[model samples]
Target: MELIARATAVVGGTIAFLRRMGSPAHQAFGATPDIPAARKQGIMTLKMPAAEGWKDGRLPVCAPGLKVNAFASGLDHPRWIEVLPNGDVLVAESKEQAGPPKTLMDHAAQATMRRVKAIGTSANRVTLWRDADGDGTAEIREVFVENQNQPFGMALVGNRFYLGNTDGIRVFDYVPGATALAGSGEPLVAFKPHGHWTRSLIVSPDGSKIYAGVGSLSNIGDQGMEAEEGRAAIWELDVATHEARIFASGLRNAVGMAWEPVTQKLWTVVNERDGLGDETPPDYLTSVVDGGFYGWPYCYWGKTVDDRVPQDAAMVAKAITPDFALGGHTASLGLCWMPDGTLPGFGAGMVIGQHGSWNRSKLSGYKLIFVPFENGMPRGPARDILSGFLSEDEKLAYGRPVGVTLGPDRKSLLMADDVGDIIWRVTGAS
Candidate 1:
């Protein structure tokens, strides 16, 4: 404990050390995490590193037996990546639109994001990248879709291509190998898109249903529940009828979604609500359940009541606990399944891109990680796939990874770094 205290003092000056003086981030990990008592600091701990992007061929430090390089760069805040059936990569480039901060905390939050260049007029476009030569770099770049409203999620199903703007999902006529859509898309479903604006999309294995994650309008319903209607839940849409229904509720900010190969279960990484100190309520990775309520506003971590919100006993009683904790404020956003043998020296598991944390004193995640799985369950501790995204002093972050997907080559991994505006490709070292 003395040595840890000594280490925290040098981590990120004084504020960081004070925040981290409670406990190391990793202790609040795994299925059964060490969740300390909740104490409302009412203070947002911002420990963002100065955004110093990659320069002069610098790259994120890869784990042993792995190498990393830019597959595509010079993007406009690419937030999500989707690999098409034809192996074409589509990037959803966007940023938060500036709005008046309602509180002093909100004001400071906005200032921090503005300094990091995280908020601006969004590009509102999807760009396509083609690595025709398979040399791991995109030689062809094209604007596939434009005039979007904070687009994030995308999917290609049969002849229909689905793209998610903050407000709704649009479907377009698409053909395999086609470079771009000919015209506008038809609206499939409308969502109340405001606070947590990102709408992540994924298709079920049978292709009969599509799932979209919609987040709450305010943290802990601070803006009132009336403003949070039809949000903080995963909406499942029927492909044939365009009908949508809530699949699961109380997922604060569920982003990444993927199917585990062995069990074929849907899984997601959720960014939990903050302000309850750093370690109490943790962001998590969990399997989604149909008609399940995981608790939000009123409860957290399976019936653990949050006194900040109006108490709802029935809601708390029904709140389901998540499967695994990914550390508080790590902002685990991007997730994808990596099959065994796809990358050398790794087994079948999930690859997660933790976009790092701003509300924590000590940074939690700004790198790619792999969680090993056995029989469709996480079997062991997470291993670092990529790291060194920040300076040694933890005061300078070069990049923050968001969306992740398997590359077309089947042997490489592609990740979108929103801060760096680059698509990084990782492959086993020769």
Candidate 2:
């Protein structure tokens, strides 16, 4: 037993030493940020912080003029949230059910997940929180929908409520004041199984179409491009005909998507590839063009080719450079636009929920950031809105922010903290 303990300690010390030495030099943030040359490796770096639950009387720190409070607590793995028009908040309690490990990489990933308490039986349900008395806290909590298959994105158009499950999009008839819903919904579109599972949905400005962001299966088409069909792109689904087509392509993992209020253009926060050192191939926020390709396996950040994949000259020529960079491997997700005139000092901007990094030598994200917009483009660097999710030493995490949305009142921001199982409310301080 003593020998085993010593061996484990040695291994842990070696890993820590490598991580400190391998930390990237450049900081990955801001619009038009620098992309340092990649330090490529055959086998990727494995660095993940240990997950630690928050202690009693502990809470995150908000920005100077903002205050933070828990709006709801004790949720079962809340991953995404949507505020209904009638002032009710719907939260998806979806967790990943990672089965037995198949390959060596799968074993390593699963081990990391187990250490972080990430693998578990999924709740597979959506809960509704209603604050009928305007108390800023939910007085009524009920199961809005149940028995879902890893549901993530949600949208409501007219009287139809759309739920994007891992395999398909389900549509249901929504009544304004109902507390709960049951019965099997009709499947609108089917998706083949893939690696990047989260499906973010949004209704177009005219409400005539729905856009769904489907992520790629492998890190860089490692399993071959044949397995990545209908993946790694945004799909435009016609509302009336239920017809769907690829709207954009080659986005490694476009998770969080929203419609810019000014330009009426679709913007997305993408998660770039891993294995390269921390600074190359920064994840981006860009205005997605219809039928456009952003270069996944063949290239990155427009024209820089990833030599790992076979060169495709034709596709490389057509790759479009993204509008903004949100840092490399930061896993930036969860996009929500600040409603016009909601807050006085804060101008037209968008809040991004960066879920933090697992592969970097040092952690990058784990907070909510605001990117100011001017004429439909990111104007400056991202400002941290709510932070302090990681320990002071950056070795432990209390929570990871996943989804951000405007509250029912439209005056504050609501963020879903999956690790803490709490809905953090942030608003301007009095």
Candidate 3:
């Protein structure tokens, strides 16, 4: 065992050294010499193909094309968006500074929630925008909630709005005229604190359970997976009993989760383990099977062992490899399976938000992708749906799409650009 450990350590060290020396891992994933030269020659102007009917700075109309209108813009880091039944779009704007001081002895503790001198203010709040007037634009903008601590995912169920934050899940009464979230609602569930602190929440289709995507605090669970509560798993909580248990584990960072339309099966987009010189473990979008274990610290993408840790015997026995593997370091985010009989060609297709990458030397994934499906399974290659988020040179990206949803009209698509603070509506060609 010690020999195996030493050998793994040596391999890891060697990989790290090679990475520092500028290996192929530093280049864009699947980028060939011919591809870059062709791009330079204006062969492929952008990484992904432009959406159909998107010309003249006006979106094209679709088969059952609905009018595409902007609800809100000029938001600061708008993370998640939930559209209410009355056509009001609620946007969660996270701008949090470091919290108050924890102790005078350890005054230099620099954490967002920990007690540290506030370097600056964070905009942890929620905003609402509605097209009150028939102006085809969002004219009414109001602050719905304020003083939140890095809230991300939100789900609206009837008259209540469920919010998932770093601390726990909080419920707010959706008063039509309530300007702010000052009127306290009931606390649903308070999760045991763990790392990878972003806890994304979603309500089950039947509303019996609340599914929370809890990410591991560190890469490969170096913090000792046993010690961490709710890390690296999809946790399901009984909405009535408030009882929470692990639905699935070893998922590293399953940041995005949604339900398929026809199958009603739960699906997730995971940001897979990093390091390993970049290309070793590809991020994945897969259907989450209950009680399944996706090899995280032990293994990855099936058979590709992550050299960072010695294989745990028990975990190895329970590990179930991911169904589909996305490209390496793509930073897969919010996903929505297209409903059946919706768009003309996008029936039952999967739309995933690629939040772009920062770890790799060269950039990748700054647009939306469509993974077509047939008989409730992924069909062929995942095609780029909405391009132009990034430039051809790969130097800079204007917007990072985080959340995607079909508008109420079912024909138009609404994309939440977190960086650009804009919700873009793509209509069919005119």
Candidate 4:
């Protein structure tokens, strides 16, 4: 028994040391990160901090001149949010259902993922929260759409409401002020299942087209590019004809997308490939070009070739560099622009919900960051709007921010905290 205990301690110590001894130092939060050498690992590394619910009267730390509070609570895995014209806030309450593992390592990874509460039985619904009186707390909360297929993103175009599910995009007729959607909408497009599952939806400025971000089937195409057909790219759908095609390719996981108000160019926050070490590749925010490839399995950050994939000169040449780097393994997911530039110190910029990372030794992200923009492009360093998600020792996670959007009044920011099961509202301190 003593021998077993000692062996366990040795193994844990070794892993801790390995996690700490990586080659590339963490990059600072900004546009141009100095990406260092890769420090690849042989096996999958697991370093998820256990989830600890927020205590009563405990709250996240807000930036100077800002205040944070629970807009709503007791949610089940709320992943994404959309604010309606009538000030209704809709949350996609969902989770990923782990499929049958194909390999022993796959099974082990899935087990570890479950242990971290990364995947679970999805609630499969969207809930509506109404703070009718403009108060901080939501007074009316009810299920808006039930029995969804792990819904993530939502967009209301005219009376037609679109919901991006794990396997398809569903549409329904929406009536303003309506609280519930009982009808099962038809699928606009059925996507290949079980890879990177979060589908972010956005409607064109003119409302003539819809874009859905479908992630890769495997990290760096381990499942082959065939399985990645119509994926690892943003899909453009015509609202009139229902026709769809790949808009951009090779974005590993473009989870959050928005249109820069000034340039009117489409932009996204992509989660770059893993296993490239602690900091060789940085997750980025970039403008999306039609028919352009950003380099996924084959390469990254424009010309940096990923040796794990087959080297193709043509593919690497066509790969365009991202506009800005959020940081290595930051898992930058949510993006929402403040068109009016009303939020003080956050002028003409966007707010991103960095879901945090579990791959690195010292954790990165797990907070809300605001990137100021000028002439439709990121211009300055990222500012932390809210933090304190991780405990002091960094051994436990109090919450992880996911989707972020402007509040009903456009004076506050609403963010979804999946682990904490709370919707946090951030406003200027009075």
Residue 382, candidate 2: C-alpha displacement in angstroms:
0.9
Q: Worst ten-residue run, lDDT, model 4?
A: 1-10
- For 199-280, candidate 1 gives per-residue lDDT tens digits of 9999999999999989888889988888888899999999989998999998888999999988999999999988777776
Q: Tens-digit lDDT track for model 4 on 186-299?
A: 789998867889999999999999999999888888877777888899999898888989999989999999989788999999999887666658899999999999998788
Models 1 onward score TM values of 0.95, 0.95, 0.77, 0.95
**Model 2, span 197-241: residue lDDT tens:** 888899998888988889998899988999999999998888899
| Candidate number with the higher lDDT (2 or 3) | 2
What do the candidate models score in CA lDDT, each in turn? 0.86, 0.83, 0.64, 0.85
Question: Which pairs of residues collide in candidate 1?
Answer: none
CA deviation > 4 Å runs, candidate 2? 1-16
Indicate whether candidate 3 or candidate 4 has the larger lDDT. 4
Superposed Cα deviation of residue 215, candidate 3 (Å): 1.0
Off by over 4 Å in 3: 1-70, 95-121, 133-136, 176-182, 192-195
Task: Please rank every candidate by lDDT, starting with the best.
Answer: 1, 4, 2, 3
